[model samples]
Target: MPEMGRLPAGTMGLAFEEAIRRLELRNRLAALFERWGYLPAATPIVDFYDVYREWVNPQHVYRFTDREGDLVVLRSDATLFLARLLGLQLSEISQPLRLWYAEETISHIPSNHPVGDTGFQAGAEYIGLPQGEADWEVIILASEALECLGLQDYRIHLGSRALARVLIEAEGQTWSKDLIRDIHRLSGPCWENLSANLRHQFQCIGEPDQIAQQLGPFASCPEAAFLLQSCDILRSAGLGERLVIDLNEVGLLSYYTGLVFKIYVPGYHEAVVSGGRYDGLLKKFGIEAPSVGFSLQQGLIEVLHGSPEPQAPPAAASGTSWLERLANARRRRAKGERVVL
Candidate 1:
């Protein structure tokens, strides 16, 4: 055999069964969205680097200069692309046009290991949607997507960009950036041990100093009373239990004007589902519409909770890839179901 081998970028070349399961997940989600009037669309894996950089990060993208001396590269995330396309191409599609898609995304993972990560994502953007309805739709879609993936034992952790900003402003300061970064790193349990005041502020009870040591400058947002009042408005319109408000929680996406959420599963370290409202993005493409959306981190979820998919015998590979067929077949045989490849 060759000393070592490397797969091509932008693809893993999966076999049929694994592809089927993924396609099933995508199809189910698309169908659900379609039933709600959200139309499905496709996006490219490459685009002008300027837009990507101005939107996400300038350096993280796999960038290069084209023959025309324009910066362009593989698009790591298609959210911006979709937004741009809709603003330019579908301006006549009526207000609040619902768009959903499942696609591969490339993004720079800025963490301890500093990885360049690529994975699958399914998301929907509601054009011209109002804050109240848009927020509710995103939360419901997130939960529904989990159900589509054959997963349970997860809860939607909700917060509002509007709420977090209000709390940060209420803390009697400009809100230190360093402090903001610190608070984000603390895990749940560690946030539970501090003094009652701090605990209430953190919305958790953990070693404050220890937690701070890990996550950084922390601010308190015990203004749940205020959030409850606002939440009442949403509840009056009917979506209280599906939503949770912790005045203390802050989010990373700067464009979020209101309402943000993360879906957590028992085993995954990162949020398996994440999204929020970005009312300002439409203006970036030179039109005016409020937008809200979220994407499912399918691959990471599978990595944490899914076994290596099975593959099949060689001859049957003619029709299509059966990467996980063998693995699934053996599992069935182990359970005394005879299958021949």
Candidate 2:
């Protein structure tokens, strides 16, 4: 075994410096949300497993047994919970509930993680709204948030789960619930390498050809002519070049039923932010309302941005200039600048 060192892997003296920069960025993010008229809200760290389960992927939520032996999960995602909230509060408000939140959420998605099962997330959701206006507003907010953070060279990738659903439902196919999930999840090489997962799920379902036909047009962004013929949702909610359509991007299976997307930094493998419209999500709460929302990956963003840390020297040793330095420190303190001990 090796002798102990000063810091652990994924932990370091630099992380402290990184945290300060992220904290500053967080404050700016909040101001943007406020200006957009999306009031802030917070959900509990631990919440009803069923509430989260109904709209969050099983792999994403961290489940455990409490001391009382009851099953509970740390809240994995905030958008779904907010959807449920708007449903219950529907009568209290009018159409298109606009709300935003800047809070930490827990995600077990990453395989190798350190102590923090937690992630700092900030996002907004619009409820009781349909595709056009509701979605555009969220997209604009996403763009603004990135601009506020001074991020450029990012693109918003768009797709519709409706196309995926339409494909599965088209052939009058009767796939098991889980198969529908896999087909919606696996893509490209994974879909081929992991066809085994889909085999059993496809057993009760019909031949594969029927499935391909509905998925054909969507496999690539629907042809321009086809997109022009899309429903009001896609019609009024036109996607631009920066906001591209992949048709195959089946994101967030647990909640989204249509119009899913993610914002990708030019070089990163995973999206910086991903979300979509889960109009049916609120129905599980006994209210039928359309909703859309997304969550930002704070840690990932910090990594990409290489957020700088404060690098103040330790208090200077006593010297002829010590008095002058002390006076300077006092002046900085008066203006709210920190004085490192």
Candidate 3:
């Protein structure tokens, strides 16, 4: 029988070897981000409820009232918090600052969902950069990170919120919050009826050039023209095969101002990686810089990449007892050499 206070569902406790592997993976990812000039950063785990409510679904956040009676939440996403943390200092920094982060985020899933309550996310933000190359840089970095984790069968699905919104606005429809929400959910009769023709074009996902050819007729639409041009650029950079353009795909976060993407592997239905450009988010934080970034779920990597390779057992000292080995280990530690007893 299970104990009265057994570990909760949708949570996990990793053992020694697995824990070490996770640590090593994090170290390698941090090293990679540093090599790309993204300085490491961290933010408080808990933030004001309003911060998350503005950008994400409030129901998914773990919330509580502090002693002062102000509502707070366990952060569901780091990108928004990062913006809030650094926004005030934008005037003091050089243009195009790159920031990287590795942290645990909490989400309260519905009872029927199989997702975990906690997950580790690693990501980077390129601030003060514009849409084209900066967006490509973040997407390529995300793909590279997935490759580093041995997930070769993954595909990146790309979309543009700015394009979608422009198309809707072109129809002269009044901006409807409910309609936007329906679009993101990709469901409901409203979106289905309104997005009929656009959905057909959006579903034409394939190599960038091929999609561009199909979208060329709509070149009169500035957003479509930009999207088509971006596609050619991505193809020139050799990402045509690995990328899928989904015009109907909507941004997961309300703040995603421009291009947005999600990474999907063969076996997992959910995105293992997600990110986008949010040029307008900084303005909300009292800053006016554009930014782009992505978050990789470490837990998903562990699941998809499988267990790390086994390491050989440490050799025992030929002429020393356990006590002598401990003493030797202490001596080595004193000399700055790492020793495992």
- What candidate 2 gets wrong by more than 4 Å, as runs, is 1-15, 57-59, 84-92, 110-117, 174-240, 307-309, 313-332, 336-341
Off by over 4 Å in 1: 1-4, 8-11, 110-116, 175-180, 186-243, 308-341
Worst 10 residues of 3 by lDDT: 311-320
- Candidate 2, 154-217: lDDT as tens digits: 7776655666555445545443446445555554343443334233232222222333343445
lDDT of 1 by residue, 1-341 (tens): 55357754434544676676677677788888888788898887777876655566655567778889997877676677788777677654356678888888876565453223668888888878767667776667677778767776776565655655554465543443333444465434333333344435545322323333322333233333333443455445444454455434455555667777777777667778888788887788777788888888777655654655565543321223365666666777777665655
Candidates' C-alpha lDDT: 0.63, 0.63, 0.78
Candidate 1: C-alpha RMSD after superposition: 8.9
How high is each candidate's TM-score?
0.72, 0.72, 0.88
TM-score of 2: 0.72
lDDT of 3 by residue, 263-322 (tens): 888888589999989988887888878888999998888877677677666544332688
**Model 2 lDDT at residue 137:** 74
Top candidate when judged by TM-score against the true structure: 3
Alpha-carbon RMSD of each model: 8.9, 7.1, 3.0
Q: Which candidate, 1 or 3, would have the higher lDDT against the true structure?
A: 3
